[model samples]
Target: MEAMYAFFMDTAGMDEMAAHITVAVIMATIMFIVMALCAIIFTWMERKVAGFLQSRYGPMRTGRWHGWAQAVADMLKILGKEDIIPAEADKPYFIFAPLLVLLGSLLAWAAIPWAPGFVAADLDLGLFYIFAVTSLVVLGILMAGWASNNKWALYGAARGAAQMVSYEIPLLLATIPVVLYTGSLNTQDIVIAQQGGVLNWFVFRDPFLFIAFWMYFIASIAETNRGPFDMPETESELVAGYHTEYTGMRFAFFFLAEYANLFLVSMIAVMVFLGGWWSPIPGLDFAPAACFVVKGVLMVFLNMWVRWTLPRVRVDQLMHLCWKVMIPVTLVCVVGAGIWMMASGAVG
Candidate 1:
């Protein structure tokens, strides 16, 4: 971005501060546009995948080919709907919840490395920053539920808060091995550590890290409230969960945040375990950003597939799986990774 500002200053003969502000705004606008497009595309893809899995056509009439414009139509319809707030709802929190959720997701993009030179912020503590920012989603969920003044919404919000908090432990634990091996918290450093080829990727480094990859993926699914672990917003039980009382563009904000989180977690998994922008071939490094996107999209596809294929678990069952199953397994993986690192003299 400094380079961008410099170029603008040189070519356009602008002041230093003006060039800096212009570059910052341009980068932010680009990020927002990219995120919005991804959300729109995934909305259509989700329905199409659901239809295929259910032995039916999805969005047949919305667009020319496979309803490519269905997402656009849905966005238009949502924008046209009335924005309604509950009569007894807490106005301030109710209005701010979705914005918080969206803000959290967008902020995460700043630290993510899409390609070699393509990170927005590149903070030394990128991993920690991601965890801190994304945790706000849970706060937004709880706020939305409580402010709605509905029992069902409150129940959903409580479940979401508990589930996200529970899963976050294993999720953080799963990344411990990557940090252990790399000895750095920066995301770009993590990705650089995994470069070389497929074998260099952390997932293939050892059995424990491989298991940790799956552990992270599972915890991420739960963290994002995807189905099979989507007890937070279980339609059969909680109506529409935390956002039950939201509508129109406000509701769309939540929807966009959900899909954005889906992509966010997938991208994190790719960067930490699957070699972020590294090409699968040993020396065939071309289109690094494309590689990252393809890998991230595949992970997102897996999330969507699992969403449509599985049934939501009971709340007690969800808690049991998190506490009794995932946490213990990830703890073992963390220990095993440490031992492997020591035994191999990989740690200094």
Candidate 2:
């Protein structure tokens, strides 16, 4: 036990091995708890927002005028669900895929710094870690699809894989401007560079980047599998896409992951193009970091707004929008940002 303890201490860079173990457990618990909280909030918000948009009362019976406890009631119902497992299903993978998706999404939150020095891990490759961890989730979706052995599942998974892969390329490229200017792969470093104010945001550094922000936002929406790019789960089409066979707690896991991922990607966009935790206007050194929270929450609401507002695109149109339109435009913007940086002496 002493030898095993020493080995982990060396690897975790901890003088005490128990601390390393404790940290991991705490981080995981925090992730689950926070994600659950966000999911509850999202459910309530979605109903109210939908009602507002449609000019009707959404949920008036349960709690207040809008039934805020609806999510809690729904959770109780989901927990009571029978937890069905198909006889034809590839049992283990079918049972495990939703957990994997949820796990991956929750873990990525470690790298996100919501407020001053509040990140879980301050790794130098924070941004890279996020990108790497998130891409594996597509494989989890594919697992759910294939394991279900349903044709609609297969089609949805295939489309999701193709769509995610195509959109990721532009999503990655559009980040070049943020990283190039910040000159660090650390997510916090990127946020810090934008802290001075609106003028100081990397997004406003040049005209190319100004255009790049919109491009990145669109690409990120597709990456998150939100509309108008939600072809995978088109109820009129695939019937819940990759999670077609999932039910009860398993299906609930996927829903939790989706909302968490939606918020994560929105936060990333906030950090990159919207100055992260900084207030919109400059010169407010006394501003509370909670202001950044307000900004990020607003950004998430904007995403939910778009989802409810827009119709899902055709699969082919989705691909065409990414490859033909967004890709080339982003490429030009990336190169233009670089050139402008050089010519204007922003880079040496």
Candidate 3:
């Protein structure tokens, strides 16, 4: 941001403070716009994918080919609906929950490097910052559930809190290999470390890291409360779960935050394992940002595919998968990665 302010100062002859403010606002606006667009597009894509998977046309009449404007129409409907608070609900916490979740998702964009020299804030602890910021979403979910003053909501929130906290361990552990290999917590540095070719990517660096990648991806799906692990919002049992009492734009915020988090975790996976913005061909400097976006989109699509393909697991099964399966596997991977790094003399 300081560099951006300097560029503005040089080009526009603006004062330092004004340049700083301008850069901050511009970056914030861009991030918000990008997230909003992703939510809109993904919602449409989700419907289309669900339609094809279930053998029926999704939205075929709302806009141009295949009803592209269906998402827009849905958004307008959500916006126009009445915002209702349940009579027994804690109004303050209930209203603030969605904003908190949305804020957590948006804050994750700060350190994500879209391309070389393109990031909102290139902090030294970028990876750590992302993990820390995103954890807040769990709290928001719990708040939403508890504040609703409904037994179902409270049960969903309890399950969600447990699931998120459980999965987060493996998720953080899985990233340890990348941090150890790159020897820097900076996200751009991690990408730069994989600059040679596809083989140079962290996922290909070692067998253990490869396993770690899958583990992280699985944990991420659970962390985000997607299907097969979506006990928090198990519609069949929980009656819409945590946000059951939320209506209108308030409910829309949670919807938007979920999609935003889907993209967030996918982008993190790309950056940590898939070579990020680096071209597959060595020394080739084609559109790096485009490459990054493509990787992220593929990851997001994978999430959607799994969500539709799998049935939600029971709450006990979900907990057992995390503690008894994922955690143990990830721990072994972390230990193996450490030993491998030392044996290969890659650690300094």
Go through the candidates in order and give the C-alpha RMSD of each one to the true structure: 1.5, 4.2, 1.4
TM-score ranking, best first: 3, 1, 2
Query: Each model's number of backbone clashes?
Result: 0, 0, 0
Task: Give lDDT tens digits, candidate 2, residues 88-140.
Answer: 99999998888778767877888887766667776798877887788877888
**What lDDT does each candidate get?**
0.92, 0.82, 0.92
lDDT of 3 by residue, 1-348 (tens): 556877899988999888878887899899999998999999999999888888999999999899999999999999999999999999999999999999999999888999998888889999999999998999999999999999999998999999999899999999998999999999999999999999999999999999999999999999899987899988998998898899999999999999999999999999999999998888875899999999999999899888899888888888888899988998899899999999999998
* Residue 187 in candidate 2, Cα distance off native in Å: 0.9
lDDT of 2 at 315: 85
Candidate 3 at residue 344, lDDT?
96
Can you write out model 1's per-residue Cα lDDT over 1-348, one digit (the tens) per residue?
557766899989999889867876787788888889999999998998899989998888877998899899999999999999999999999999999999889899878999986788779999989999998899999999999999999999999999999999999999988998999999999999998999999999999999999999999999999998988888887899999999999999999999989999999999999999999887888899999999999999999899899887888898898899989999999889999999998987
> How far off is residue 217 in model 1, in Å?
0.6
Residue pairs in clash, model 3: none
Give the least accurate 10-residue stretch of model 1, judged by summed lDDT. Answer: 19-28
Off by over 4 Å in 1: 9-20
